[model samples]
Target: MEAFTTHTGRAVPLRRSNVDTDQIIPAHWLKKVTRDGFEDGLFEAWRKDEEFILNRPERQGATVLVAGPDFGTGSSREHAVWALQNYGFKTVISSRFADIFRGNSLKNGLLTVVLPQRTVDALWELTEADPTVEITVDLVARKVTAPGVEADFELDENARWRLLEGLDDISITLRHEEDIAAYEAKRPSFKPRTLTV
Candidate 1:
């Protein structure tokens, strides 16, 4: 996963609530073996509608998503995060998010920010009013900054560290290379061997 320190870009305001994994990337798209190419599936159903916010030309390259409350409120699926990232969203801001979806997003280096409903609404208004408006999300400062908006967000230190260092689960386990090598050397010859670093 790519490291996330800070990001500044335009945002696409999505006012609909209860956007689930399937809506983010329909289940049909999950049949693919690789993570790439899901960009086309991001909001596949909604994209079919000519009036969808994402379909607007001005918001084409937006890297931030300002969504309604209860964003990502359905089943656990990492693909949702992938689709968003593939579709060019580096950060997501909302009043609330499903625990599983938030976890999936963070682990994949997609920052999920939670703020008060009032603050989120303000952001939505700002972006919707001006598609060229830029919003900055600073992970190190745990703050989001934009014109007339400055809000702090919280993220556990460990997750923050992982994102800063670009460490995934496998990368984390590999950090103990020497320790794993030492333990494996002392294991009983009769025991089955596990993969080593």
Candidate 2:
């Protein structure tokens, strides 16, 4: 996973509440075994509508997503996070997020910023008025800022550390490799085996 220190880019405003995982990436897209290529499936159903915000030419290449309340509220699908990341979104800003989806996003190095409804509304308006407006997310400072707008967002300390360090679960475990090896060497042979083999 790529480290998220600071990101500044145009934001795609998705002003719809209760955006479930299925809407972010349709269930049919989950058939793939690998994480790559899910970008084509991100918001597959919504993209069908030529009028959708994502289909707008001005919103093309947006790396930040400014969404409404209750974003990512639905089934526990990490693929939803994968789809967003693959689609070039490094951060998703919303007033609220489902617990499972937030966790998945953080684990995958996707920054999910929770701001007040008023702050989110202002961002949406700003983006709508000018698609070129750049939104900056500063993970080190725990802040999101845009033209004439700035707000602080909350993130778990551990998650923030992980992202800043670019450390995935495996990477974090590997940091303790030497200690694990030492512990294993001291283990008694009488200990029950975890695997039948």
Per-residue C-alpha lDDT of model 1 across residues 1-197, encoded as one tens digit per residue = 89999999999999988988889989899998997789999999999998899999998899999998889988887889999999899999999999999999988999999999899989998988888999999999999999999999998999999998888788788999999999988999777658753
Model 2 agreement with the true structure over 68-131: per-residue lDDT tens digits: 8999999998999999999999999999999999999988889999999999989999999999
All candidates' TM-scores? Answer: 0.87, 0.87
Clashing pairs in 2: none
Judged by whole-model lDDT over C-alpha atoms, candidate 2 comes out at: 0.92
Model 1, global lDDT: 0.92
Give the per-residue Cα lDDT of candidate 1 at 135: 99
User: CA lDDT of 57 in candidate 1?
Assistant: 94
> Candidate 2: deviation at residue 83, Å?
0.7
User: Runs in model 2 with CA error above 4 Å?
Assistant: 174-197
Query: What is the Cα-based lDDT of residue 69 in candidate 1?
Result: 84
Superposed by TM-score, candidate 1 places the C-alpha of residue 52 at a distance from the truth, in angstroms, of: 0.4
Against the reference, the lDDT scores of all candidates come to 0.92, 0.92
